[model samples]
Target: MTTTRPIQSGRRYRRIIYALIGVGIASLLGGMFLDYSLAGLVVYAVTAVGALALTLFLQFGSEIELQDEREREIGRRASDVTFQLFGYLGLVVFVAMFLLEATSQYTMTARAETLLYAYAVICLTWGGIYVVFRYRS
Candidate 1:
């Protein structure tokens, strides 16, 4: 008799979904604060759809419908590549900005710095999660 293994990494998918939902919410809020009512509504709608999808997946998804080993492997590889690319891009942007600031009289704006900080935080969090799982396993 042969037994099949269930997709055990459902939690990972859940985390990703939740993260996306969080981003959508943040975008919505930022739009509202900036008086972009239409954009905010659009963001809210998209976030609602994402939440609905998460709910449906949690309630009705089967093991095979979740993610198999091969799918998980592909996701990991994609994530690693994306993270590396983002890191390189961020480093280039940072160095360019640093040189520009040093050589010119212009300074970084508060809004730009805030966005950069947020991106840095997101990257750090994503990388930290990857490291935790890679070493834990």
Candidate 2:
């Protein structure tokens, strides 16, 4: 008789969490494209709540050690790069939109205005966080 090793509980839990996240994303995307019925709204709300609960459980409830120090360092570097890249890209796009409106008859759309406001907020938040961190460190 062939013997099989049982799966570790931590690994099994991680797989379940990944599957749930995938299903949640798929349902959210499906809900976005389809009609906005009451049932659809309920499904979306449930999915969102489930996802949030899973995230919180992963953060505080579970005893599973997910990432090592190296992994966390890599994640921090990636996050820093992503934040800078998006901030610069948003600034460039906002400036281009503003210049186009200034030079030509093209008027900024509501979406463009929204982007401008979002970029401003992002910059301000980043600056404030930087100041706090700089002073704290």
Candidate 3:
């Protein structure tokens, strides 16, 4: 590869960062798949944030481990892709929630908390990724 690739990470920290990403994704998936309850969704969102924090800490901890130009571009493109995805996902959920409320005969109340938290996760994820990408860029 070009000089753009970052130095290969040591196994320990590399494993830690990889695990953090996996756990973060798992948390998000679990939140969506679990019962349609506010509390469970909140707990899962918290877990995702914790995983995100850990990833940031390990990734930038090494001065010499900084990503090069190609890596920076990769990170940016990745975040932009993720942001578009979550943005659409959140908007669809919100629209569906409102539409269901408007026309449904059942007096079903939408869980505002769940909707808010879902959007919050999208916001935070996009923001976090944007920051990392921008900094590296």
Candidate 4:
């Protein structure tokens, strides 16, 4: 006698996510390159649909056991490391730009200045969350 195991819900969810991403990218490319009048609307609709799917998945993923605790912990650590790396890299770029501007006739563009300010805000928010979590623990 042979026993068959059912497919995992996590695998099904990942496949759905991949399909959504593929459709979204295709729609975006078509919108950019095609001459259709409704191309922009199609792209927007695809993006909205993808976002809704993701929101739903996030809301119910834990309850469904979409990821095991080990997987979830790994994801959390990976995201934390990614954010820390981005913060440090942004700080380096900001300092380099400032130094270049101060030592030469180079002036930072408005967009770059805005990005620096945005980075500052993100870092401050992260710090606040860290403090809250620290005290709560």
lDDT of 1 by residue, 6-44 (tens): 554565666667877887888888888999968977987
Q: Which residue runs of candidate 1 sit more than 4 Å off their true CA positions?
A: 1-64
The count of residue-pair clashes in candidate 3 stands at 0
- Model 3 residue 58 lDDT? 57
| Poorest stretch of ten by lDDT in candidate 1 | 3-12
Model 4, position 133, has a per-residue lDDT of 100
What overall lDDT, based on C-alpha atoms, would model 4 receive against the true structure? Answer: 0.77
Q: RMSD for each model, in Å, please?
A: 7.6, 4.7, 8.6, 3.8
TM-scores of the models, in the order given? 0.54, 0.72, 0.45, 0.73
- For candidate 4, report its TM-score: 0.73
The digit string of per-residue lDDT tens for model 4 on 4-103 reads 2323665566667677767767776676778663775576577768867774865565544456678789999999999989988998989999999999
Q: Least lDDT summed over 10 consecutive residues: which range in candidate 2?
A: 3-12
Give the C-alpha miss distance for residue 55 in model 2, angstroms. Answer: 2.3
Candidate number of the best lDDT: 1
Better of 1 and 4 by lDDT: 1
Model 3: CA > 4 A from native: 1-6, 9-16, 19-62, 105-112, 124-137
Q: Encode model 3's per-residue lDDT on 1-137: one tens digit a residue.
A: 55533455534445665676666566556656775456555655665677567656756664445455787899989978997887888788767766776788334445775666778886887689879999998
Best candidate, TM-score: 4
What's model 4's lDDT at 34? 82
